[model samples]
Target: MTQNEPAATTGDQETVALTRPPTALSGDLSPRSSGTVFESAEPPAAASGGEPPEDPPSAPKAAKPPRKRRGLLIGALAVVVVVALGATAVFTIEPVGRVFGIGPSAVPTEPAPDPIDPDFALIPVDHVSAGPTEAGLASALQPSVTAAEVGTLHAVIVDPGTGQSLWGNEADVPATPASTTKILTSAAALLTFPADHTFTTTVVAGPTPGSVILVGGGDPSLTAVPEGTDTLYASNPARISDLAAQVRENAGDIAITEVLVDASRYTGQAIADGWDASDAPSSYGGFIEPLMLDGGRSDPLNDLSQRVGDPALEAGNALAAELGATSVSAVDEAGSPADGEVLGEISSLPLVDLIEAMMLLSDNVAAEMLAREVAIERGAEPSFAGGAASIIEVLGENGFDISQLELSDASGLSNQNLITPNLLGDVLSLAAHPADESDTAVSQQLRPMLTGLAVAGASGKLTDRYPAGASAGRGWVRAKTGSLTAVNGLAGVVTDRDGKLMAFALLSSGTNATVARPALDEVTSALRECGCR
Candidate 1:
């Protein structure tokens, strides 16, 4: 890589002769040079098979060999740049000053496109299977559960490749599902509704003039992103400001004075029966109301922030503020106007987006609303109990067994909720395998759950769970996480070392979540490393 030895031609490079030799400028190196002294010369010596002439015919005083310094100064010789790759050397040169006293012009070229940054780094798209033995897989995973200080733990690992059980330890028993219940909730929602279905919110004329109702259709993705800004959710939901503008437009010659909210699409207790008192209004859980902003998050943008006590009333109040109401208007329940005079309408993000958000963030509020949506679709009451029942009904109809389950709430926030590792595995396996099985329609729809599950050490709830000890599974394991003070679960699909997809469920109880979560994570991590054939 060193300079070409100043034309000595060292290393692997050969010095290419300059197409034209350097010549002294008839004039000085400044302003004008077209009218200086001139000299006529013969072809350069290199082309004539001889050395440079003793002196140009018109040199200032050259009849004999010129002085060494004078020759070097007069003809510095064009610099020829050489580049070598392996045994091949390429030479290039930029001719400056003059070649035969003529200046060379550079060719014009198109500029390169500006490089744009990619959203995320590319990861391995293809998985290679090591094809390990199944009996060996069971032997390898059995101890992660049996050797731990964890109590009341159950685990099941099944290869999605052959629909065969690879490992299990008390896996058929029902245990607290924690937030993992959202997985079932998500599957049922996708099963009962179209992937593009959106929760609808409508604004209609109220019972009296100068009044309007913001009818909540359970669109939890709604946000107040000003009149023309984007929301993090793909929905681009109905904004209260937009509704207010429409209300103003319809009211024409008069200023509307009041705004009301109707949140009756879902009817039931705001809180599930078996939920702990502290669960709601906490950072992780919220009132299970039909209408809420940003999943009832007090901060609207922070998923882990505390929730409001009455999400519906808060939403109504937000609408009232947006409408510039002088006084707080009492919210009332009412259907859309009988005359079909609608002021505004907004649809939540497509149902698939809600499922992804629920699974990625383990969003309890979104999960509950989706469950109720499932209930509504199934001709059942849109309540917690009804939603849970509807999920069971939908899953049972889709070739999954729910006989050993008790789902008190759709969110799995209730300690009373129970689910078997076997069901979890079966549900997950449904997503990994083909759609030609029974309930083909349902299975096809449920396949999106695979994408919704957070990638290990990469996204959503599972982002921070896979530490260095589990580095082997990073970007390889995909799973949903469940955690309460004493309950922890991890269940999802993973491509085993053998490249065969595996569905696993690890539910543990009677241990601190801090300890149980990592232990369960280790179990899934084991699946990623297992090459069971």
Candidate 2:
């Protein structure tokens, strides 16, 4: 049997057809068409009755057109071409964009070439040396200076730009900085707050119409008493008086029978943790409360009887009296004014100006208040801890190495506070020449500091020390004086013989400050006579 034939079955016969229909190359094929016919060309097959002729093997359909192969090759070549084009475009565009196009303008043109003179290039603090050479100021003061003597002397002389010790007996040691601490507080204040910023004291109505509360915002310079009046010592604070007048004006037909002062903003803890309990509770170490009016005093003139209690309550009482109210009481809670009207509000000096005053007078109270303000402004815990932390942050930001420095309070009241002369000098330099010129807060606020310094025996604590004369520091030295029992400190700017401004700090501990003042004055005289040759 042929391969195409099926095996015979007993009861049925079946035929299998294996021929496939011919496919036209383009369109349908016709019998009369000119195309070749496979049937006429084939040899005759055996008759159906005879043994089936051996079926010839059919050839595979014309091998499929090479279209698929061509398509795959074209796709591969297209991908290659695309890749080449992209690479060429990138290579051609990059250098052109860099050289001709605006691309950051060649590393910023070297920062406008700093205009510092080479000869007067102030020595940087880090590179200062302490050897015994003509250029080394520390060496001149070392041989005659003893560690014990170092702690006794107050004045120190050094280059503001360089941390080098020019001539100081106890330059390396730490001493009570007194109001000099205001410098740090001012620095931190300026850095944390705006220059034009003012402290607001609001007189808000209490829960009842007849009751008004005085809210203290720690404004150290607030005053209700007139300047140069005997009643100034007995009268109420200025802002409080204004608020009372406003209430009276608003309550034209009505009468305020009761006034309550609210002093609840600050913590009850008045004295700092490290403060000496034995020390007198003078106005300088005034109570620390949130609602203090006129800096926690009933009168600015007399510190002895200036009633120290809840400040807000005092203010409220004063306002009540001024408003013709019959009753006044200190309230722990806040309340609205009797007339439901806002009384006149008073603001303390700007932070910069306040700082300046604090610096010049070396006022401990101002320094403490400023420190608290700085703490509050920085969103830190509003206490001595917060103040110290704020100071460290400010110093670090201004490029000070505060690793060896320790501070407990802004006034340097605590003996625990310690700082080296080098660090102090560095801070002075920064204060004198702040990195950010736009920031005038510190410079403006530090005016009081300069005014507070002993003007060559002109006034304040230094009135008798550095007398104005050819032999004394007349106009050559202007500095802040610090004294705390055994601790003595003097830090400020002085103009040398060559008219160069220099900042210095001399701190002494473990000696009588009164006795050390003369020696410190001598040191200042030496610096004025002998320029840093």
Candidate 3:
């Protein structure tokens, strides 16, 4: 729900795979640097020796003022030199040396830390503590979670290492999850599809001569941008113009007259149940058509631009213009000719990239498309009901309890969605589980969701959050945010002050987002700063 604001207040609202760690996914582990850095201080001078008694007559300069005294001074001087050299070593080892507050490297040139590695599998492995006890965590969280702004809170904190809830407050109660519903959709997609899978849009010969049929492949990211232009969704998206070029070349000098659009891949309502019709033409979302350009945006380059009501037909018109056709129309109920010759085809970006983008930007359109893809793959109807049922089915099969879960759409734009904080915590626990501690097949497949989460106050919809009282969680918390009229939710993982990783979920109802959001953030910030053993 944190996407670009829609004009009509309808637009933006926005895995389950189990497998062992695959060799192809391995990478160098880069853990978060632990331990404190302190500046080295000079040892206090030895009592000053009374400042040499104001030069005291040059101390009766006898030939080296006693051999025993001279020997002692030489020994002391040797000790000082050795200590200084060791201190210098501590300061000169670059990043490693900076960890110890000694030596010449004590004063770092840069104050800010380096960015965290984007790979989720490479999370920090060393934990200094066993994690907070339930009592301790409750003590630290009670005040924040119960604040006036956080109405009817349902929350839980879990230690991913053991898959146990350490602290909770009515966490089993169901609440509107808003955009956090993407967690279920994204998980189901990853579980059902290969990471490198792609969707293809194709053009083929129409039934009539000099006519072409454009077949939709359910790829909403397809763009109408010119060859040299940049795209908002994919780095290099499949272009509509390219398809037209292929059509021109294949057809030779034949005069192209009509373009028939085929959107038979998806069935049922173009819009999901409970979604506001005004939302589609605004910036938040659009109809879930099989064929659409720039996610149905009126302006391809502007993410917040209004969307078209008939994206499938709109796509057909674009192709018609490119082919210099005189008329464009949608295929009849019977659909495009089954044996039409393939004229031109383009593939979308890989599933892995699309999922990441969907999570990061809270792309309502992308979420819906991917959800339907999951439904289709699972042999369910490709409608809103089917997509919702498919997500619950896949997650339920993979060992998650769905007794209390309910969904109306993949994107949380629908207010009908209900999810328990405990369930979300369970999903995040699997995602944040350490590889060495848990070898379950499901955990590995869910690992990528960790990287997709927005870093609090640093990335995605959370970029503007975690200010002031909650600033401690800024870069430390990675979460999926959800917000609607009276619903606010956050679910993610964070490393506590003692280096222990914990997954948490907090859902608030009957409160304004502006107030509930900050209160929820404060509670998580408390978790980040807690050493509540």
Best TM-score goes to which candidate? 3
What overall lDDT goes with each candidate model?
A: 0.59, 0.47, 0.66
Cα deviation of 418 in candidate 2 (Å)? 1.5
Q: How many residue pairs clash in each candidate?
A: 5, 29, 11
What ordering of candidates by TM-score runs from best to worst? 3, 1, 2
Taking the tens digit of each residue's C-alpha lDDT, what string does model 1 give over 1-533?
00001121325322221110011222222111111111112222211000111122344233222111000011111111112211112122122111111133212122111111111111122222334476878776776666464667887887554556777778888988877788899888877886667777777777777677777788877776575544433324557677677777876775667766677788887678776655666656777777778878776544435678888777777777877765444454455465746877766666766676667656777888888888988899999889999999999988888899899888877778889989998877766653222324545676656656765544455544445333345445667777654677778876554445677888887876546656776677676666544
Clashes of 2: 29
Q: After superposition, how far is residue 464 of candidate 2 from its true place, in Å?
A: 3.3
Q: What TM-scores do the predictions have?
A: 0.73, 0.64, 0.76
The numbered model that scores best in lDDT is 3
On a 0 to 1 TM-score scale, where does candidate 2 land against the true structure?
0.64
Error of 1 at 360 (Å): 1.3
**What lDDT is reached at residue 68 by model 1?**
10
Each prediction's Cα RMSD? 27.4, 42.3, 21.4
Better of 2 and 3 by TM-score: 3
As a whole number from 0 to 100, the lDDT of residue 201 in candidate 3 is 95
Instruction: Put down candidate 3 lDDT per residue, 203-284, tens digits, no spaces.
Output: 9998889999999997877887788665655446788998898999988887789999998887877667766654555456
